[model samples]
Target: MYTTKIGLAPAIHDSFIASEPLGHLLQSSKWQEIKDNWNSEIIGFFDDDQLVASVSILIRPLPLGFTMLYLPRGIAMDYENTALLDYIFEALKKYGKSQKAIFIKFDPAIQNLPENEKVIQKLKNLGAKWMGLTAEMHDTIQPRFNAVVYKADFDEEKFNKKTRQALRKARNSHTIVKFGRDELLDDFSEMIQKTEHRKGISLRNRDYFEKLVDTYQADANITMVYLDLKALLIEAQTMFDQAQKAFETKETTNEKKIKQLENACSKAKKDLSVLTDLVQANGDIVAVSSALTVNFGTHTEHLYAGTDTDYQKYYTAYLAWFESIQYMFDRGAETVNMGGLENSLLETDGLLKFKKNFNPKIEEYVGEFDIPVSRLLYPIVNKLYMMRKTRI
Candidate 1:
């Protein structure tokens, strides 16, 4: 006795299963809250009066008075239940036709599909066209990915040996590792910045990272990694020294002001030195990584990770990741997902290679699947978007 209906609005039935951030990130968050805001409708699916799935569709106004329905992570449902998928698509198609949507693009979270071809074939048979991975992710909503997942009974030793030499190296190094968000954020931000810079990319400023820490810190599962005082001290001293030297050369005629500035500098340097030693004394060693463990029922995903790449030679990143994985396993996590990456750009790229060294089995997923409601107008919109990209 199964029934299907589109829950147009969020309500009590949606609460049947305990909610988590993944669900919210996929459904509940306001349309405007997403960094790439979309204008359109969001719908949730219910079965037998129980909420089971949800979807967010972005309808972009196109030229010649047409629009398109772009579903980032669309059509969330019970993947194993073919009937449920069929019911949900019928509801979506009906809804799309009414709104004059050009197409519906869905990227379900179902991974490790036994037969990718069969699933694609079934979708096509269901009137959902298969859009191959062709364009850059910007052209689509979610990027095609091969996620690295640690299984329920993952062997830590096996994973370490298969992945990277660094994890062992990190353990051997005398670097202090501290977990939890109570630790200093400025240091973490700096470390992340250094890593990003090394990879020839710019990272969000300290404020953005601080927000992640502040928002998720209360959750005991969220962990932060810390490197030793010696490493922190080296960078801190270097930055301070450079600033102090520059300040000394500035044309300042006031003797009293100069003396006051010198005293401040001296104290600051002294404090920095002491703090460095303090961190060094609390040794866990080599490197550290901070991560937020997100739980959705029994499934847990590692959201964001910040690591000390400066000590890569010592394999701090590997050590930090290995320990973190062990920590997640101990917490009864069914899956420890490393999260998605810009794989196309990274494969063969040093960072990609580094992440791969961990011996993670690839979880291949569809790049972006779209169901066009009105194909005629969608092209015009696509052209304009391409033009804009070219201009940028």
Candidate 2:
């Protein structure tokens, strides 16, 4: 038998959460604070008097005096363990009745692997309903398909080879800037609006981001790819000067030194050309591309992002992600989740193509599940859910 309790010691919760191989940022305690409007609870499942599994449930008032139980990225537990899952369902149903929960929804972080067939059977055996496999972003609370960058034992430089190329091209046109509570709400809002307009997608408001940044503190950051033409021009002139000095040095004729000098001079001239063009076309900052990221345990996730399309030619967005990845590496994070993509498997998906530039592999999860507390109300709620999704 297992015991379900609300709120454990801080260390106990943190240790188990960090240890889950499939853990996610959404499950973090800080996230509970961000969703201030929702009634959130952290439930720990104990077996043999040891803290075994945990989950964070977000409850929102639904129609007709009922509440909806949403477990973002699902309950953090070993889904393959039948006994453990049995206890989880029992506890959730009992807890749901008291809270007037209509049904419990979960989209765990489990990936789609060949061996997961047995696990899928267990989920079914435990009376959980399966849902969703669409390529479109709609119809799910969290993305079912994700691109996670998890190679930490390897070289960060090798990982950044493509980013270095973007930096080389973007060097003379822009710079990367990271911001926090520094009035980023307004800037991010503007860029977010622009990106939504161009991409035909709906994003959250600035107020929501304010809460995210305010709550997550050390775990969250706002990074801007600032296209400052003046800064680029100054940097270009400095590089050109260095190249000129190196060309005039005594080692210019030495074969090894000559090769190095040529490479430097060639890069300086190429960057100067772009810088001159940018400075002439625009002054000061040409664009501001920003990305928001959160880190938990060994993982870092890039969430909402905005880009000023005017400077897309300069690849400022790529530079922004490059630096974001670097930030994760500096913190010794084992992986970086570059956010969501569609599972359509379409080779031409623009988002997929863009993320592929960073050489990240696509991860299609085992899919979402519906753990019904009241089987009678569960089907009724499904109809209402479809209506809500369409309205959105």
- Cα RMSD of all models vs. native, in order, equals 11.5, 6.3
User: What tens digits encode model 1's per-residue C-alpha lDDT throughout 1-392?
Assistant: 34444345534322422253233234432322333445656566666666676676666665555566766555555455788778777777778887777667677654435566677777777777665654454544554554555564356555545354555565544455665553556656666676687668766766765555554344325354545556556656776786588567857888887887787678668857765765666552333465555443345555556665544555566656656666766766556666665646555666556556555666656655556565675566556755896665
Supply candidate 1's per-residue lDDT for 255: 83
Predicted structure with the largest lDDT when compared to the true one:
2
| Residue-pair clashes per candidate | 18, 0
Question: What do the candidate models score in CA lDDT, each in turn?
Answer: 0.58, 0.78
> What overall lDDT, based on C-alpha atoms, would model 2 receive against the true structure?
0.78
Q: Which portions of model 2 show Cα errors greater than 4 Å? A: 9-11, 132-135, 153-164, 174-176, 179-185, 231-283, 390-392
Residue 336 error for model 2, in Å? 0.9
Point to the candidate with the largest TM-score.
Answer: 2
lDDT (10s digit) by residue, model 2, range 159-197: 456656776777656575766654667777788999999
